[model samples]
Target: MRGLHIVGGNQLTGTVTAHGAKNAVLPILAATVLCKHSTIVNCPDLSDVAVSCHILQHLGYRVQRQQSTLTIAREEEGCRDVPPEWMRAMRSSILFLGGMLARCGRITLCPPGGCALGGRPIDLHLSALRQMGAVITEEGDTLRCTAPGGLHGAAVQLPYPSVGATENLLIAAAGTPAETKIIGAAAEPEIIDLIAYLQSCGAFIEYQPGGNLLVQGRRELPGCLHRVLPDRIEAATYLAAAAITGGKITVHANPAHLAAPLAVLRRMGCSITAEENAISLAAPERLQGAGSVVTLPYPGFPTDLQAIFMALATAAEGYTTFTETVFPRRWAHVEELRRMGADITVAGSHAVVRGAPLSGAALTCTDLRAGAAVALAALAAEGESTVTAISHIERGYADFVPTLRTLGAEITLTEV
Candidate 1:
């Protein structure tokens, strides 16, 4: 385990470029199993990516990574069963189910695991696969799925627009022999990037205006070079870190992908500038409280950034309410935040945060985003603070401590 020590009350100033999207690259990496050879550019160096690569290599694929680029090629007939240990490392490991089933017509794996934010049921994913002619059976901790008659196009409608389930269906449908139409599909920019990647590989996929995704499956797909989009959640975290410390920071990220967070930050009285491929934020001397925000699907407030935003609210003058409709147990960080003198009350799906002066305190990160929130709050505190369980932070953000240090933040990582 590792921890971060921060000497607070330093105004961060500098420029940092956003890394590639973790959410985007995981599914794309899984999709590579369907291609003969593929190259993914602008990939982030994160623990999750390393885990995804391990799963691919475990299945007999040759994975060569050079900095921000990854090349995957199918070297032999791959195994159908993914190592249970690898599957337990990250939630996105479940994504390989679709790709494995497409290439080998069978897949056996354990339940996927990652940050224990809440009960993220794979019932939606299982139900969608069963609708596409997959026979699924669960025994103890392992799940066995086989499509003997081969996958065919089906009219599948999701109860919710889950990003994982949407990607799984798209990848599974891409190799089927017919057209698959998905309703209530997720409309995230990551999903659009996946669609573009598949389209470039000769898979016909389109998004209709009214929340529909059409996929025309083929027997074979040719590999192509694809670059992932910028991580909006990571960009938003840096912006919030700057605002909490009363700093001005510019991020080299796509403004179009970060409209929601930028809009919310502007509502909190931060000076924001949007350019072609970069966005800048200048904090106010005294930040005003943003009234309330609800975490919704894409184009709405993202659930991933809710924790970081709550950290920013600690510096506000008034109360800020956060309604987390996406995950039931996302407020695990609220208890840890209270250790640093933050006044926060959690009532079921909602939390009311009262702004107050903070002092440094020892804290533990409850999840990935929660670790980021605690780090940002520590940066704004009056004294030194220590944050443990930093491995959760490393799962998403690449070079987190060094990146903050570049922006004039007094933070250091110590292994324990």
Candidate 2:
């Protein structure tokens, strides 16, 4: 296990260029298999994206990674399809099953792995593929999918706008032979990024005036190069960390893209100044507690930032409520934070946090964003802190300890 050794009571102050969206890059990488020609992608160094590339390679795609760039082309022997062993390693591995099944007419995948925040079932993905005329079977831990003669697009209405389900459907629909329309589509920036990549590859897709998407499938996709958008969630985490520790940091990314989280920061009395592509935040010596925050989908307070904001709430002078609507059981980190001297109580999906001075303790990361929250709280705490099982953090955050250390934080990493 790898743990981050953080000496607390230091302010993070520096300029940090945000990386590509871990969420956006994964599904986009899965979409590369739809192309007969090589596809080039410029992305940041994120472990999850790299792991997705490895899964693709195991499926027999010729993949090359140089720094932040990835070039992927079909192998001479074609792909043998992604196996169940590699699929169980990461949640995004499920994404390739749809694309590969649509194009290759067969695919098999195991249940994917990631942080245990809540029950993230792939039933929506399976149902959508079934509606598109695919034969799907479940045998114990493996999912076997076959879409003979390729897939035909069908109208899919997601019970909930799951980002993974939406991307799976979109990628599968892009390679199919019929027109596919998705109702109540997730309008997140990540979804838009995937749509842009599909459009670049000759898929005719349009976002209707209402909340629906229309995709016209094509026979083959052209070789294309694309650059990923900067990670908004990472930007929010850093911004909240700066506010929690009473420091100033300029994030060089699209600031307007962070309106929701930035609004929450401003409400918490953090002084925020913004430019076109960069935003600088300076926390007040004393933070004023914003009473309540409810996490929602796109254009709302993101669930991804709920953990970070909970940490920020700890530095406030009063009480704050963090509510999770997307994942009912996502407050697993509340108990971990309480162990570190934070006054917090978890009630189902909501957490009631009372502002208190936090002291160091040995903490374990319950999930990916939760680990980031742990770091945020530790930076504002009174003494040294050790965060264990940080593989979840490493999956989404690239060079995390170094990034924090560059901002005047005292942190080191040890493998134990």
Candidate 3:
């Protein structure tokens, strides 16, 4: 069992560069089966990444990892069906459904699992694949999909913009020699990064108006090298940590990707300076609470940052309200924050937080982002806090503790 121990009241100040986006890396890796070889750079060293590599090896790909770079080459006969354990390891494992289906006309896997966020159904993904001519059968907890005649390009009309569905369809359509139009697709920066990687590997993709994604699989895609985009969530987390501790820090990342978060910080009385490739934030002595914030699809405030912002609200002067639309049950951090002597109330998908003098207490990590939220609270608290279940936090952020230490956080990890 591993846990994080944090001594409170240390203001983090310094510069940090965000690692590659995990959301980008996973789908790109899933899409790699469409190519014969691939070389990816700037990938964060995370536990999920190691699992992805294990999956690649299971698919008969020779994988070589060197720090932040991964080189993959096919060495043996690729396997179409991944084990149930692998699929159950992370929700992202469901992404293999599309890639494997495209690579080998069939695939067998169990329901994917991760941090139980609540009601993350893959109905859109399955329905869209059905629209594209995939015959899927659900047997118990397993899903068996077969595309005997192979998939074709069709208009995938989604009820809402779901990122996983969009990425899965793009990976499937990239291998089907026809045009696939994804209507009402998610427009997250991670989606754009996937399109960039696919384009670099010889797939024809267009980001059209009305949030539609068009993919033309006119030719076979070969492997190509691509450096993933900076992780906006990681960068935003750094900013939130700085704000809660009333510190100043510069984060090297794309400013455009962080527009929504930066705007919220600016509204909270923080001094914000945005450059072409980097953004800096200087928090006030006593931070003022940001007003209401609602999470919507991209170009809006991201749902991923909601927990971190909620943590930030506890350290602010007034009230801050957060409404989570993506995963409404993502209130795992609220109880932990309350244990640390913060004031918070949750009803349905909304949480209202008030600034209170916080004292550290023993806590637990519930999910990835929620784990980060509690850790941020530990930094701003008045004493010491021990947070267990750190494996959740490692699934996404790269060099999380090291990065915090670099920024002068009084934190350490005890691995047992």
- Judged by lDDT, which candidate is best? 1
Candidate 2 residues 1-416, lDDT tens each? 88988877888899988888888889899998888655545586876877887877876777887878888877754547676666766789889977887778897767788777797888888998888888988899777789877788798988888888889999999988789999888888989999998899889999997689999987678657878888999988888878888899999888867888888888889999999889999998888778889988888888988888998888788888988898888987787788778898887888888889888888989889999999889888989889998988988888788889889888899886
User: What is the alpha-carbon lDDT of model 3 when measured against the actual structure?
Assistant: 0.90
lDDT tens digits, residue span 126-244, model 1: 99989998999999998999999788789999999999999999999998878999999998999998988989989998778779999997777888999999998899999999999
lDDT (Cα, tens digit) per residue for candidate 3, span 1-416: 99999999999999999899999999999888888899999998988888888888898898898989999887875566888888888889888888777778799888888888889999988999988889999999989899888887899898999999989998999888899999999989999999999899888998889889889974357889999999999999999999989999999999999888898898888999999889999999998889999998999999889989888898889999999999998898899999988899899999899989899999999999999999999999999999999999999998899989988899999874
In order of appearance, the predictions have TM-scores of 0.99, 0.97, 0.98
**CA lDDT, every prediction?**
0.91, 0.85, 0.90
Position 378, candidate 3: lDDT: 95
How much is the lDDT of residue 401 in candidate 1?
A: 91
Worst 10 residues of 1 by lDDT: 73-82
Show where candidate 1 strays beyond 4 Å: none
